[model samples]
Target: MEGIAIKLNKNISLSLLALIFFLIGLFSIYTEVFSGIDRMILDYKFRHLQQEDSNKKIVLVSIDEKSLSYFNSNGMYWPWPREFYQIVTDYFHESGAELIVYDILFDTPDFDRRNLSGTMSDRRFLQSLKRSNNAILAFKSTENEDPAVDLSMNNEPLIEHYNIKNDPPYKEPHLLTSKPLDKFAKAATGLGNTVMSPDEDGLIRSIHLFDSLAYKGFVPTLSMAAFLELQPDTVSLEWTSSGLRIGDQNIPLQDNGDYLINWYEKGGVRNGTFPYYSFQAIVKSAIQKMRNPDAEVSVPPSVLEDKIIIVGASAAGLGDIKSTPISSLEPFPGMEIQATILNNLIGNNFITQPPTWIAILILLLISIGIPFVIAYSRPGKGAAAIISILFAIIGIGLALFTYERIWFSTGLYLIMATIAYSGSAAYKYFAEEKQKKEIRSAFGQYVQPEFVEQLIAQPNLLKLGGQKKRLTVLFSDIAGFTSISEEKAPEELVSFLNEYLGTMTDIIFKHSGTVDKYIGDAVMAFWGAPIDQDNHAELACRSTLKMMQKVKELAPQDTNIHSRFGIATGDMIVGNIGSYNRFNYTVLGDTVNLAARLEAANKKFGSNTMIAEKTYEDVKDVFYGRQLDFLVVKGKTKPVRVYELMGEKSDPDTEELEKIISTYQKGLDFYLNREWDKAMNRFQEVLSLKPEDGPSETYIERCKKFKEEPPPKDWDGVFHLKTK
Candidate 1:
């Protein structure tokens, strides 16, 4: 009962520890205690795992170093005249481009009094914007209110038509507004905010689709503006707590109303993720077309047709570079970030983070499940299981991101599992050490040192309960102990018995046997208990042989002191037996009784050691012995075949013993067949070979008595012993 209570308490303690870890994980997740590490893991997944290909419909037009150099040589410096944009817009409008989005801000009108061509340049750019209804211009929005800027300038007539309806009136505060100059905003098809918000880590992982301005209402991002313009008709926009739904497409959003951007590999310039073309290349193509109608252009019509082109500056000096999840060492361009957002919106390939409940549930499972598994398992096996589960979680997260575009919180799960394992392992180590100390204190003097160690390593073996096991039990007693005790004085006899018993006990322990007890002149021991031994029968047999040899060496030259052994192998109950206050680690069953009876029967056969049939069968290959008789003891009804154990097969006199055993078996066979004369002849031959062969001499007398009596007709050959 006490052991059961201890076991239950241990399990409860492990569960409580697991619960503590689970609560810690839950707190960490909700509080974002390890968000930085979580983000790093997310970035690692994006960088290494398989990525989705960039949308081909989106194209990038970079005003790179080459274009800047070409224009500078031609006397056109930075912020080139608006006529340059007019030329590119006219080329794209004539080439059948679907949408042309400029990520550049044009908040002020060109007014160069010295050139006198600035007004003309502005007029030409305005005319191109009105001509190409697909063009969208960029503007800026800020949280800081600017008193110098007229706030009423946000109420432009052209920006009002793209108002997205919010049924519930999104209560999130809107930012202060800025817009392109009135003439340019009125001439362009639409205007969008170009402001980008990066994460706390300074990486642009998400973008706001719509910014609710202070008074101008909701303003769409540059990407969202182009997307809205591509719609076949004016669609209703509904905003809920989840996200905005435009027409039939549902866009998932974070709590702050930002859509997570699924990044693509960093493929730069032409022949990369998205097809790239230089500003000089587009301008040169337009010039070539104006010069000759049949001239081959740099960017063919087919490449630009039906494509959404994003025109933005990419020169290093422009300071448009931003860090992104996929951009590790390389500086990602702001133009490419805009292009990526637009691509995600167009394709509906945004990465969605599942609900907080899902992450919490995963964290809870890992924290609780890992400790429970580790608590019941061996140390080495438990460590292996923990490592395997961690990898499986990572693989599952990566697989979901790669194929489903779903982001699972795997980093938190790993942290929770690691904590659970660490706590469980430390507890197990200390608990085992405590168990070892208790085992040494309790069983040190009772059992051998090695047996105590075995119990310590596997403490469950010390439970106060019996379990049925196939075991080999040994009973050894001194032959004629009453007479030997009568001959020696009390003090001398005590010393002699202690020496004999101690030697025999040492031999039993050496063979990994547990000494059940020591009766005055007898020793009870067993194998296959406290520790499992598959070769229990062989071990018991070997111990008995060594004990017999040691007795001869320990006895004085004048005195005859011989030890006889009996061994039986069968199912027996082995465990602690008796009241709670006092108990003995021992085995009890019919097998044990048979072994004790065999020890007493050894005196009848005049043999040093005897073993039951089952024991002989188990060690037949290693031991050399001969069958004695199918004798039923006084209290037993059923008969059991017994064998007198001889030396091992490796003994020097094994050949001579084999010949004697062969003769003895033949004599017994004749006796069982009722051939009295032939049985006497075979027994006499065995006795001649071995002068003191006990079973042979006894069998010869039995044959003689049977010949004189001419026993009953239905008589079987089984012999019954009258004494134990």
Candidate 2:
């Protein structure tokens, strides 16, 4: 029984612990509490797994420090004349460039004070765009509404040229837009928005391919615009459960409708991954070509031929530097991000994540599985298992990310697994193992060796510290023990006490009771603690009767040796009591005290065994016992009804004892009613039937005394014993 209880408790505790960790895992994933750790891990993977080469079709024209310095030295400050861009545009066009994408937002008109006709520079740039027929200008999408910007003049042309079919729109509409002046926007082959919103950590990881406009329909991104310009027959865009599909290619999208970018090796004018040309170098090439038409230039025409040219600033002062997964210490330029997006689109390469349900399923498996592994296995084996699980999760996550471009939330799984293992291990150590030690040390001698082993196996049977419980306590003492000790020699007395205590203890143990302590010739014991027993009262009463019978059988023929016992059942505090250096596992409270008082009260009634009413009530169906008195013993204010336990109902003498008990109860009733004559007659009848009955004789004497001096009218037949 104790083993079953302990096992149940352990199972419940471990299950609850696992459930708590599972909930924590779910909450952490939903809230992204450990996203920073995940991001750091992703950055590490990016750094280690970066490609050695970049896309060959994309060329970067960087307006870097050298270009800015050279232009500044040549009397061209920042924001050089639009005619300078016209020269570069014509050079790329003549070189047979597939597409020229400007990541610079030319929202405001170009006004050059040095030019005689300020509008002439804008006209020249527009003419170059018209002649090239491959220029895609950048625009900005804003949340703030701008009523001042006219929408009627070129709205139809812009929408007709750039709008793609958005079947089942995936993103919210951008209510407003900021684009180049009417002249430039109308003259450009196409327009794309360059809106790059970073994550909360300020790292740009994804971009939206198409954003719906309030009055202008859908506008594609700069990369999307370049793709469309190169493939004009593509039209429809559709949103699916996993991602978006444009023409024949499918692009993965996050839950927020943003496409994750699969970055290549960092490339710019400073690096050689992509074909990088400085803005000043391109301008010099154009100027040299105009000078002689066949002049040799710093940048050859073959470099730009059939390649997508991305024009944007790379200088730190331009405020286009962005933190990407590849590098944060040295950031990627915004122009490079656009080029990377274009490369991904062209190559059909993008990073994807598994569905939320898949992550939750994995979390649930680890959260529930790891705890059981830790709980059932040995400590070393459990630790090994946990480490193996951790490695497996990390390995699988890295493999998927490397080969399949699939990112799984492995950090969340690791957190859940670590917490489950540590929590289960800690509970086993502190709650189960510690309890076993306590039970072994406390009950080693009080209980049988086999019982102690059982207790150790199921330590949950005992609550080591003080706890209130309903238990039956017993106290026994040898009647006239002091006189017997005085008559015998020291050795004889020791031998007699040893025999008597040993016999009584054996009887108590036979009934599964704990011998609490022995005080000289007296023994104290209890049932129903350290373990639970439904019939604790019956066990205590049976032990009391057996001990009394054993005392009679063990005594010498001439010597009169008798033992008195008192049993009680009630709520009492049972635990290890006394100082730390020396403590006894004992029972305390009024229940224990009452049992001791009842043992002493046996002398007054001349009864061998007495039990409190609570104990009698619990065992009445099995044991034959009669009411003794409403006793308020020494140091107590409340009266308790006590009974003298005669024998079990199955005993041969039970019938005779019941007849005597009936007569005695009748006399007690009459005596309490103040009918002295009637009570005396009943008592005489009881003595006639059993001449040696001490209670009947005592009641007769009580009736005579009460006849002479009647008890007070308020008296309730309660007997108060004045001595301990």
Candidate 3:
């Protein structure tokens, strides 16, 4: 029955610990501390996953450092004459390219304003766009102002198809606030916004399809505008519960009407993953071709056949660099990002985020499951369980990403599982330590310090039964405690007692003595039971002498305080001895009773410390002591030999102290032999040697009493105490 109760308690404590860990895990997940970590893990997965091929139909013409250097060498800086773009566009149109998309905006007139030869460069650029008929010009929008265009010239098909007034996909949005000349805007195929919205982590992972115009409904993004140009007729715009529909294609839009761009390839690699042509090289080739029909070009004109050209800067000085998961420190060009978006639209490799409900459910499962598994498993097994869960979670995430292009938040689950498992382990460790602390608090004073630690390690050692062993016991009390207590008030008396007892207890513990109990001002202690000590007798005697010395140091100015000690060594049963609910560890036998009586006997002997003959024998070689006399203590039948413990043999004043002891021993010898005058003279001589000596003065009075009224001739040397 007792065993069953213990097991039940153990289970209950484990359950409580598991619950605490689960709650903490839940809080961490709820606060989205794992969100950023999850995103980072996704980035890693994206980098390691199988690389996708770049769109064959798309090509990037970068205005890179090589192009900048080439142009600068020709005495021309950037924002080159619009004639450059005009010539490039004309060449692409002539090369059978389906579309020419300019990521750069021609929002203002040329600064030179000087028409060369027949026409201004802006008019020539506009004429080139009209000739291609498939050119898509990029523009930007601002919420502050509308573009200075003829708002009456409507793409009526866009407005009439879906007349949803003031909707997010159609209302007061980033209006096209900048534009080329009105004649140029009117002649272009279509104007699209080139604003790419990056996620909070500064990676352009997606693009909004269009930006709303306050006056003209909405304007499509560059990719969307190009797609529209491919359609022969105006496509209908339909909004359903799922997403927006253009023509027969259903476009899945996020909550904010943005498309998640599926990046096709990594950046910052040899040859990258996309075909790139230097803009200056292409322009120079085109100009040379226009001048001389058979000029050699850096790139073959056939490469642009049926391809969509993207014109944007890739030079670091141009500041078009953007952060992507593929290259963090080294920025990916914005032109490449747009090319990816365009390719994503064509390939339909858009990534879809799972609903919030699924994320919450996964969080709940991990938070509860991890802690429970770890808390229930055996210590080492818990770590294995955590590993298994971690692998399973990551595997599931990778499977989803690989097979379905779905990105699951595996990082959060892994972190939550790890934290919950670790928290459970920490909780168990601290809980065990707390139990050990309680054990130490309960029995620290009653058992030797070493035994207290042992009890913490092996609690079964604490029980009711004890074994009989030869041990040393000590008892100490203030010699005149009654008189001292009578002089002080209750508060002052408690303060005084605590200070003295606290100091004495520290000394006892330092010497490895078990303080058995404190009875009023008296302290009972023992050694060699809880923790075995071969020199328990010596330790007890040494502690008593130190206590006497410490009391002298703490002596009051108005009155002196002294401590009396009695120590003995004998066979005694030591362990818990009392009622079951209120038991204490102590020694019991004649040895303990004799020690107690010896402590009281100090009142009659005028000695600070006393020890049994057995204790004296054990420490006789290491200590300096004086043989006092034999005493038949109260409740003890046999007369036990006693000694007055002075100090160790290494004491500085031992030589002088031994001389006084010799004189006192002589007086004791004469008194025991019933020599009245001789004993009195010897004690007087000892007193003359040390006039303030208590033992010598005491023996002097005893000799006087014996001389006045001598005992019978058969009187033994044993002294009897009338009071205990």
Best by TM-score: 1
Please tell me which model should have the higher lDDT, number 1 or number 2: 1
Using TM-score as the yardstick, the better of models 2 and 3 is 2
lDDT of 1: 0.82
Best by lDDT: 1
lDDT of 3 by residue, 346-409 (tens): 7666676676567767766766666566655667797888888889988989888877778766
Higher-lDDT candidate among 2 and 3?
2
What lDDT tens digits, residue by residue, belong to model 1 across residues 1-724? 6457667888898889878998898788768788777788888877776465656798889999999999999888888889889999999988899999998887778866446588898999999998988888888776544434456555554355553666323334345456677888888777777788777889877777876666456778888888888875678788776688888988888765677777776646744467789999999999898788689988977799999999998888998877888776455778788888888888888788888888877777787788778878888899899999999988888888888878877777888788888888888888888878867865665467988987887887765667889999999988767887898899999999999988988888888888888888889999988788899999999999999999999887777668889999999998777776666778999999999999989888888888999999999999999999998987999999999988799878678789888888888888888999998898889888888777877887888899999668887877899998
Question: Candidate 2, residues 264-289: lDDT per residue as tens digits?
Answer: 66555556356678899999999999
Local distance difference test, per candidate?
0.82, 0.81, 0.76
Q: Residue 716, candidate 3: how far off, in angstroms?
A: 64
Q: List the residue pairs that clash in candidate 3.
A: none
User: How well does candidate 1 score on lDDT at residue 181?
Assistant: 74
lDDT of 3 at 627: 80
Error of 2 at 335 (Å): 0.4
